[model samples]
Target: MSYDTEHVRNPGGAPERITGIPTFTELLANVDLASLYTDIYLSTATTGPELAETADVSKKTAYEYLRKLERAGLVSETGDSDGTRSYEATAFEMTFTVSDVEVSITPELVVVIAHADEFPVIERVLEERGLVTFALAYDLVVAHSEGNVTVRQLATLTDLSSGTAYDIVEAIYEIADLGDDDAGPTTYSPNDVADEPTDLLEELTDE
Candidate 1:
């Protein structure tokens, strides 16, 4: 007797949604919090139970991922529904403060920017200066971009040690030609200083 094999219309009971949400599309290329954020965001729904079920993750995992989105101010709680909380996807506006001014950013805007497409071209700067110095460099650059920031404030922003902070300020001075030769305190903008050559310090040493 010959046996007939049956072909099922759907295998494994339908395709399963992918796990892990990404915070940013670029992050998909790497394993990072951004990617994790994106994954959970795509999987979850406004309904708590539905979200938990869709992500195929425990409630705790769902909550944690949701919290990350909340902290970034990308997600907001819509309101309570049937005694259960509900959330809806909101457009992510890339907004941040520089100096005392607020700036709103958009994905399309980032795409057109010369250096905005990728994150952290300053990794090498950090490697050379250590985490503290790298952070100082980053904050100071941001301040410069925003058009105003004090050294002390930048220090706090970057969490740099006093000595490290001073060094960063000096480095900016040299880069922008606002050295002691200038009458006023050296002030620079992030946009102006952010594009320093990767080998700037090295090149300076060879001179």
Candidate 2:
């Protein structure tokens, strides 16, 4: 998971230069904090206990973090069960662009941009598929876009159960606003990438 910088020489006897480069300090801080935020973004935790266990933080700390995220407009109360309040991510995305430099970036950083449940696609996905299901749904979306449309084929390609593949397809359809009206069985378009995510780290990317 380490990114090694690759230097590309400018052609035509021009000086080699990079643009919009982020400083080491900015890079470190953005990356460090981005990891923590990404954890929350991609977490499947719907309750304090669940979040604490998943994030490896204390329950109290988990609640505290959730409060912070809530204030930051990243999470909100969804429901309650057995006296425990259930919470879910509110759908937000964060990105830091590093330009004019020898940058080595990973797709992990640009996972998803969900803030305040603003995006309809994101809201629908979180509402229908939940946080954990996003990764599965995203993989299926990509695979389907690449021409694998059958349940059996998608399951075989993703190593998921047939039933699970079906569910992921359903979610992708829901997210993309596709429905029973389509002539064909189902197809995912890359235009819907805004809400489709294959990784749980949350959607983010650099320019």
Candidate 3:
């Protein structure tokens, strides 16, 4: 899967879209919160009870998390004809720019964060390396999936040991398999960004 370069950079001008770093970080750290958010995100629309059943939590727990998600701008609530309230995930894109490089967190990344407990390597990467590196790792995993980079090159680019890089690759494969119900994982490549420095280009080009 791939995203339009411009759409990913700006997402959209939607007022409901979330772009704050703090909010993104807060959501990323909580597995249950992330799970509830993803269920809404990947669904057409769902209610608190449905979310609780799908996420294997109680109704009260689901509504509580739904409120938190609504407050964070990750999900929006709508009323049903029977006076029941349904929730849907909102459009969101969290992006950070450093110098000339920018990384936007994708929905697939959020799914991975939600299921991080199932993959120790991925969990470790997020816990130790933080969000930026985790985003870069996702890109690197996509590059590897497309045969654009090898594990050794991934290690060089990420500054991770080869063993850890390989583990991440395996973990990503598992995550992608688990996401068969949702949109397949998409990627953004730094190479797609034009006029980057010669040395940076050379590094990408290097064996």
Candidate 4:
């Protein structure tokens, strides 16, 4: 996966824009497909059989998801010489702005969504709270990890109960391994955005 730093920081900074992305509804509804997409996104390039094995799905299912992803412009064929079709996921950062709030859908969030089955809290949040809330939770978790926000502040801003906010932060902490100093490098972070939710909320509330 490749991303230009300037393009990530400011969506308009890119020379070319990506089209034909799947709708958020389509993305959130297909967890298994999202998992396969994440697997491809994390790798340099991979074949259908390799993805099938990694995601524990049948070859047919893997290929089906890959076709869907290809149609959505998320993955592209790498033209392997061995006659096996390999693919690479497109690196992208899509920001949706509604009123004063912005929600970004990046590879990191995709990983979080893909691992929903492995993380009960993430699944619970997705099933109950919905994708927007989950994205906000992820941002808040990042803010908290960086000491920019507190659990009470998260609850206040998001109207979630303090306990719920704490749980969300903890769950994201484990999922993203924010506490692990040895955790590998990541493409996305709180600093990647021009205005984090905490800052936006602070300005809105005059905090």
Candidate 5:
């Protein structure tokens, strides 16, 4: 979908046709909480029952969470009836600091993004490999995108064990589209990673 909501940036005024529910498309007041809900809704439109089933909450709790998401401007009600309502996630980039913590939310780093349609190939890869796996690989590739980064650095960035990070090189080699024979299940130093991540990028997109 085409960024259903306008991205809010540092201390902006409210948006046009802003919701009356206090948070109206400005930088999020509660960045972490907003990220949690936005992540849940970004890739799909869901109704109360559907959300309840997936989130394993009571129907009333689902509706309560839905209300909060609506207020946060991350979700807008698309349909409603005497007994039902559907809410769709809206795309919005966010950068905010709460206390000493800073966050940047975008389509690339997060498994769920409201602009999933814009990156259909990425979406397809996510569909194929699933979000948890793809996000790890994505983090790995992005870390190395700048230049070679150590397995320890990747482990820290991707929240994998050092050994797990080391093991992933085999999978990366199998999936890499490049002709680098050195990538194929060969011994690599804990401090070594490819200088380029173009192979992963190419696998993720036609562009």
Candidate 6:
């Protein structure tokens, strides 16, 4: 079956300006070689062979680019299957001041490490729900506040499949050390804790 190449590249224009985090534009400016790193992260995975093909490069070229990303501490190689390697992006952190409130952000870039120039729906998922939820999670932790937005709500609002929404929710729960309160069904509460994700990524890659 033939698939459209641009299918994932169209994440509906640039992501909306995040309230207290850098936009992709700001990231590209402040983080050296941002575009190259983003390109490599998005394209190096097994699913997006066409990215390398379209770039007129060999798999070796893609690997080399990914290697650079590794050295820069931006991505880490996961594992190999049938001689093809997998990779996961490192978490990206930034600080911004909005409305006189200084905020810090550490978000999963979730840029479809395998699919490169596609991930249209996934990117949409990130824009509408994931990034904002990251910020909200952090904010809630800082303010010592509580609220509930169920996985079903997220699934419906973001148009993500239930499984995808569960994946995202589980990741967030794991990262934040969050757990459910009054659980007949699961509802999550952010913990008063902070973690550096380096060790976590290493553990994940090792597995």
Per-model lDDT: 0.46, 0.46, 0.72, 0.73, 0.50, 0.44
- TM-score of every prediction relative to native: 0.28, 0.31, 0.71, 0.72, 0.43, 0.29
lDDT of 1 by residue, 1-207 (tens): 233346333343544453223443332232233333444345444655655565545678767666765655555677786798766545555444556544454432222221212333333334454433453454454454344555554545556654555555555444344534644334444553454455443443365
Name the candidate, 2 or 3, with the larger TM-score value: 3
Off by over 4 Å in 4: 1-19, 182-200, 203-207
Supply the TM-score for candidate 5: 0.43
Q: What would the per-residue lDDT of candidate 3 be over residues 1-207, giving only the tens digit for each residue?
A: 334575464535543554545556766788877888888888888887788788757778877888777877778886675877788888877677866678787767888788877878878988788777888888777777776666666666777877788788778867766334553333335464344343542565474
Question: Lowest summed-lDDT stretch of 10 residues in model 3?
Answer: 178-187
Candidate 5 per-residue lDDT over residues 1-207, each given as its tens digit: 122345544444444574533543222233333334554556466676667666545667656766776776767878776678877776665555545444455533433333343344444444554445545555455444434445555555545565655555434433333225554433346455545353543443443
The weakest ten consecutive residues by lDDT in model 6 span: 108-117
| Residue-wise C-alpha lDDT for candidate 6, range 152-190, written one tens digit per residue | 444444456666655555454443445654322243333
* lDDT (tens digit, per residue) of candidate 2 on 66-114: 6665655555677788988776554532333344222323223223322
Candidate 2 achieves a global lDDT of 0.46
Clashing pairs in 4: none
The lDDT of model 6 is 0.44
TM-score of 3: 0.71
How many clashing residue pairs appear in each of the predictions shown? 16, 23, 0, 0, 0, 4
